[model samples]
Target chain A: MPSTAGAALPERSRDLRAFAGPVVEWAIWIAVLAWVFWQTQRFDREIAQYAFGAAGWPRALCIAAALGATGQLIYRIAEIRRGRAAVPEAAGPEIAAPESAAPEGQKPGLWQRAKHLPIFIFPLIYLYLVPSVGFYVATPFFILGLLLILEVRTLRALLGVTCVVYGLVLLLFTRFFYVALPVGRIESFYDINNAIIGIARYGM
Target chain B: MEQFLDGTFNLFGDGQAVLIFALGLIGGMLFGAIPGVNMLTLGAVLLPFTITMQPEHAVMLFSVIYCAGVFGGAITAILFNIPGAPENAPTCFDGYPMTMQGRSGKAIGAAVSCSAIGGVASAVLMMSATGLIASWAVRAFGPQEVFALIFFGLAVSASIGAENLWKGWLSVFAGLIIATVGTDPVGGIPRFNEGSFFGLEFSSYYLSAGIHFIPMILGFFAVSEVLTQAMHISKGTRERPKAGLDFPTIAEFLSVRWTMLRSIVIGFFAGILPGIGATLAAFLGYSQAHRWSKKRANFGKGELEGVVASETANNAATGAAMIPLLALGLPGGALTAMIMGIFQIHGMEPGPLIFVNSGDLVWITFAAMFWANLFIILLGWLQTKTVVQILRVPFRWLAPGILLLAVIGAYALRNLFIDVWVMFLAGIVGYLLRRSGYSAAGVVLGLILGKLGESAFSKSMQLMDYNFFGFFERPISALLITLGIAAIIVSIINEIRGADVQKALMD
Candidate 1:
């Protein structure tokens, strides 16, 4: 009986660990709602007498959110207590790794998660370059960079795909639709675009 | 009925109209068949070009795209087990299984035929119902009634959240707060700007201009999908199934006729209700099919009825979703919201007045939907072999191209760099919220409804002479508000029951 009881103790502790992340998330959400409520105080108070004033709806929504978050936190706590567990497993991790490493198995480490970071980072860098390098110049490089990050290693396949995609987009958006893609500081960009459009339309 | 016939003939009379319809159908199918590329993204990309076209042509193009896009997603679902759109998620249950069993042709055939039938039926329903609803709404609804309806929409949307009801409500509140950042709809005063919080120049122009829906959508759906897919780049691809033009037998079609009809009814009604879109319709339809079937054990194991149930319902929703948009100016889902934006761009507001003002345009749009569904069936049948080939495209190749389109779509909205930044920021926020079990649908619904809700509330306040209780004085508004309350109560009870079940499991 002692051995069985000892075995159940670790299982209960693991359950508690699972609940920790959700509890923290709920607490953070509550704090954010409280901040939102505080922020509403800064709205123009002179118009507060109106039933649907500038601040009226916002204040109501903030209060409701705060209360909801508080209720969720309390419910989660009660759940933990009643289940005789420290935590239950956090939701949203069934598909991916959990927020924290479980005692039973390996969690996805920082490096594993960071591998996908370039998916987002590349877009930011591409957008930043668009205004300076111009869309026509920046797009190919963006496509090339993404393909590389996605681990497409064959250079021939990369260039061929990039050219096809870029050429189609350029022809469609710039030539057919006349979309004014940003030309950056390059005065020659327009000339190049027009030359391509002219060739496509009237033939070389 | 004569007007509908005339509109249908008139649309096909012009050769340009046929060309545009064909283009939209083909384009929508190609884009939507690719996983991570949806109708909304394709619509956003094409929105800029529509400015140069005639308004009727533009409307027809988008309407066709909307219909075809719903059908397109099932192809990938059958071939790849990855749903091209959220509405097609349920199709994957039996669709991919059938592909594994080498019955891809039968599954595809049923999906195509049922989708077209469901779309035509829903379009007919929309044609009959929308005009009546519009006339009634125009007569009976005031700002109070509109506010009550939008409130009900928010409640329904929150109840459908993927996680806990409270979290859904929280997301809705957060969305409402985000919507409040720009100029107040009632007062035209900028709230939550740099002046209100930090004294920074960055928020001056962009905040005043407000967050464009196009950028927000492109970020949330397209960029987030790109990132998610990027994470799975290391996964190996499956060999493409040999798709053939094997049309379903007459007997098979007859067997599922009742299921198809039931799904169409469910999908149409669900679409009429604001914020409950095709995803829910598909789910409800599939579940009902399983419940009503004799061979329920075969449901998830390559059942043809499952494919029919999901595809038919989702396709049926395409036309029914437009009912609210045309009648009350309330968009029920993302696709309809984008269509609403197009309506606004064409200088035609999509409220009850649209029926009175541009009734011809509405009828023409309805006719266009019928033709679009026919085109989907005809074209999908003819191109089954080619369409299925899209599944063989590597994700590594597909994701970047979609990312480029997302950037281009975001930029084309207003030709402002700030809009691009907004899209990026919204994408990050959407990703984080989605990762935390909060539904992005709630936030998006809140954002779409926020300004309309605010205007209605403010108007109601003025109409009632500042008496909050006066909302109950109107019969329809009172009924709607009661419904809203009932919805919230039901959601909470469900949440509590779910928690109790979880507790029992743990114990």
Candidate 2:
């Protein structure tokens, strides 16, 4: 009986791990809906006579989201329960592979997910820099940083690709389309920028 | 026929018109082939330049771009797993598989051919039926009917989440909730902007403007893809396959002729409906193909018919989407919405009366579309010769380039820094939802249709003395509502039966 209990432990744990993502999603949905429902109370109740006021659609949507999330939670739980019993070891590799390869102990932590952090962070940093540094000034650095994160080894290839892409965007947005890319702190920079634009448009 | 001939003569009579058509086709194709940049972005960028050209030339340029952009998205979808645009999502289901099978050239050829055929067929349909369809649609659809139709669109879009009906419904409702952030369509009163909710102060200005779609699309599809690819960067490079301009033979084309024809019909009708864009048309077309095909089991595993179905329907919707714009002054999708702006800028209002007021311009535009389709076939075939080489570039190098384009595309929308932040937030949300097996397309469809649906519902309420159930009293409205309910039931049944939900539907 003791040996039997030991064998069942890992299987049970695997099932729990599988349910973790769905549980978190459900919690997020519920929280969002709760906030939405609370906000609906603030909408003016007297504006429209028909079909509920400005809050009507939002309130209905919130309720529907709550119900849907609840239903999904139940369905996912059932699937996990059924899957553990019905799925066999002798089935196809795609189904059996996960069970056989299950980690013996604790799941990987935040450190394991850290590899994806830089790629996600790059966009955020780029956006923050765009307004102050301006698009033309910010883009090359942005591309250079992303390339380094993506593991472009050689400096030559990195600089070459960055320059080409930046030049093309500069020509297209500034010269051809005349899109007002932010000028940043230096107002006198416009003279040089306009000269480059002139060269692109009508030749020096 | 006379008008078409006259339009054709006028188009060729001027070298400038021909040059503009060629440039629009090439430029749109290039933009659409990039993963994060779409034709609508290209249209927005070129909109300023159109100010300098004749109104006829501007219209012609936009028409060419619309046709080429729709077709160009399939190129990357076939060669890479990434879709160039949302409408190309379905194409990636089989297209990337075909690439894995070293049939990239053949898949691309079929995609281009079918897309051109679908575009030409819809253009013909538009020429023949736009006047009649417009007049009838304007007369037949009141706010109540339009609301019902939008509700039906939402239902059909939700049905796309066949793997998880509840999650799909949740996504749809979440999208609707997001749409309600701005001022009410009827009352002009802000609903969700208060001092603080959930410990975050809601900005009245941001809430009033609401979220833009392009930024959301870039985040959901492009930014999320970057994160996903980053995780897999350690997998090392795979072997590259040989690809070229290998157009399908007559027999090969004939084999999928029936599929293409059905897709064209499906796409044309889907386009006529307001707010139902190319993405939904592609999904519906692919789903119908899976339902009808004998080898449905082989669909996601590199089936040629899958590529044909998606590309054909998406491009076909391009022409059909223009019908409402030309007929009722109602823009169908982002691309048409921008085109409508261009029309207004050029002093040619696009309504039923446009045919009378700007008959020559209308004929010229139709002629341009025809020429544009032909031009895409030629230019696309040439593009295939070199585009396949993109796979040879290391993904590590390509990833950063894509990221740059994604940023630029987001910023280009309104040149607003806040939009960029919105895109980043949307990307995180998209990544989470995708990891949880929820459909991002459902969320996007909901976003697209939500505003239209709410406004129509509110207007209809005003029309019918506040009785919500009165939506079902009208014949067309009743039919639409019944269809919407039936679609939900069918999707639920499909889910219960454990049908093989195609990844194309999960976009």
DockQ of 1: 0.33
Instruction: List, residue by residue over A1-204, the lDDT tens digit for candidate 2.
Output: 999999899988877787885689799889989977887778757674555777788887888889889877876677566663321211111111112223345455777667658877777887776666566666778888878877777989899878877777777666766666664555554454555556766778
Listed for every candidate in order, the interface RMSD values in angstroms are 6.0, 6.9
CAPRI docking class of candidate 2:
acceptable
Worst 10 residues of 1 chain B by lDDT: B234-243
Give lDDT tens digits, candidate 1, residues B1-507. 987897787788889888888889988887677654568767877888878887778877888898999888888777655456767766766786676566777888888888899899999988888867545545677789878877875775562323456776877777777777777766676666654234433346567776665566566655654564565553222233455446779999999999999999878765666665576577667767865776555665678998999899988988888887888888877767777877888788887788789877787889999889977888888767566555457757876777776677677767788888887887787667656666455565566567768878888988899888898999989998998888788767756665323223434
For candidate 2, write residues B1-507 as lDDT tens digits: 899888898898989988898888898898889765678778887888888898888988888888899888888777755567778877876786677667888889888888899999988988888989877766888889878877876776573422357766887787778778778887788766564755866555665677766677677666765665565453232334446446678898888889999999888877777776687688778867876887765676678898999899988888888889998899887778877888888777888798898888888889889778877788878887789877777766676667666776767667776667877788788766655546555676677678888889888988998887898899999998998898887876765555634422322
In terms of docking quality, how is candidate 1 classified? Answer: acceptable
**Runs off by more than 4 Å, candidate 1:** A1-19, A41-50, A84-104, A110-114, A186-204, B1-115, B126-131, B159-161, B195-202, B234-368, B382-384, B499-507
User: Which portions of model 2 miss their true places by more than 4 Å?
Assistant: A1-24, A81-111, A185-204, B35-37, B41-55, B77-86, B159-163, B191-204, B235-252, B295-302, B328-359, B500-507
Candidate 1 residue pairs that clash: A15-A87, A16-A86, A16-A87
